[model samples]
Target: MSIIRSERRNRYTTISNTVFTNNQLSFQAMGMLSYILSKPDNWSVSPAQLITVTKNTAKKTARDGVYAILKELKDTGFVGIEKLSTGDTNYIVYDTPIAKKPNPYNTDMGDPNTAKPDPYKPDPSEPTLIKTDIKQELKSNNKDLLSSKHDDTNPSDKNSDSAKQVIQHLNAVTGSKFQCCKSNINHINGRLNDGYTVEDLCLVITQKQIEWGSDGKMAQYIRPSTLFKASKFSGYLQAAKITKLNPDNRPVTLADFDDLTWGKDLGL
Candidate 1:
């Protein structure tokens, strides 16, 4: 069976298929998560509000059902509850289940105003780098790449040095002339700011060249725009890492085979 999708240009939520395939979550929980994600980052709803919207708010059975779904969401790591001193509760919803301890203070979950100070931001207080989870890392990278805000650290002279090095490596492996222009720097800096080491970037370029270098059509994608894209970089890195682990997967060139003295051992 195939699923048809509408072309959503604006106000659409991007969710991973992992949520749907998650056997641990019920259909009701999935629906609730979709509804929560569809709203603005600052949008919040209370348990009482949900119960009140139910068929019979005055009945205990209806309230219990609401509470059960909420509990399931919480236990499954889709939501974290924070009770404020002012007696208002905030729900911290995540696109993916929490892998680490849920920091209630974390404001990256759909909030425009991030309460937690992110070092990856363009104008970080210090010239230091702080590694973050993949979700926050991707968000920071996208913001740095898209926004017009340029600082000394993120999209500045200091940042271009590393991006140049990455571009140089790409050129070295792919034999292509790619300069550290705005577009190239933006994509390279995005990955750099995401805590990917220089070695990681080099490995990705080297591996992609080996995989795509032979085919003329595929070789065109060896450019910075394709290699360092946000959606494709991590996956390429993972694949490159696997190739590094298994050296046997490397291409067997003409050097790998030796000319044999045929029938030398045969008593002809």
Candidate 2:
């Protein structure tokens, strides 16, 4: 069956809290649920289709990995799988409730068995309306104000928060006395906005600290100003990954560090 697009404009899916709380579920399983929920309700999908979609979105692309995630999602009651009458075809179906268009005239009045009220009948108990337009305008303005206050964070604030987190992680890992400064914050925020996650930054820092913590020449360069500079931050990320894969191996020469601009070349 074809998927239906309703009135929702954001184009997002809902993931319930239980999915996170379930110890049996992994991150891959949660991602699969999100993909399923994004489709229209009652839509049928096969195990092969799920595996393909999961492979595209997640890092764990093994067939057994996909099967394990699907099994977990199924066992948790997040999705249902059924075998058709043909007995050869199996379809996985999302079990969540779907949204239906609201009707103004057909009010259920909280009881499904209740009879519909006459539209022609005027109720005298209804409250009298006065200055409704002005009241509605005021309410709308208040709502807009509240939305502005709560919905979005200032870009500067986001940058500062991300920078602070990076700095905190660095201090914890390197045993350094580095404080947040305008220059380092801008550099850290720039890398973060370039699509590197906070965890990625921390991993880079942790790997570098382990590599350079003892060397007097390199230890001095572990400060925020030297490591987090925009021109060299990407190189440090690559270097960290290299170090993680080969902890004991070191670059052959100092020139090797100069050629470590892989992150810069990728525009990371």
| TM-score quality measure for candidate 2 | 0.33
Q: What is candidate 1's CA lDDT for residue 199?
A: 65
Q: How close is candidate 1 to the true structure, as a TM-score?
A: 0.36
Cα TM-score per model: 0.36, 0.33
| Candidate 1 positional error at 135, Å | 26
Residue 210 shift from truth in candidate 1, angstroms: 0.5
Tens-place lDDT digits, model 2, residues 1-268: 9998788678677666655665746787777777667778655543433433423233534334455565556556565454334222343544442233344655546744336432223246863222212223323333222112222334556666656666755653454546666666666777788888765666566556555654547867776777767788789888766765673432211111112122221111
In model 1, which residue pairs have backbone atoms overlapping below 3 Å? 41-110
> Candidate 2 local accuracy as lDDT?
0.51
Cα lDDT tens digits for candidate 1, 19-128: 78758789877876786677688765544334333332233223334545666677777777765552234568887877546557555567454664432233444643
> Whose lDDT is greatest here?
1
In model 2, where do residues sit more than 4 Å from their true spots?
Answer: 1-156, 246-268
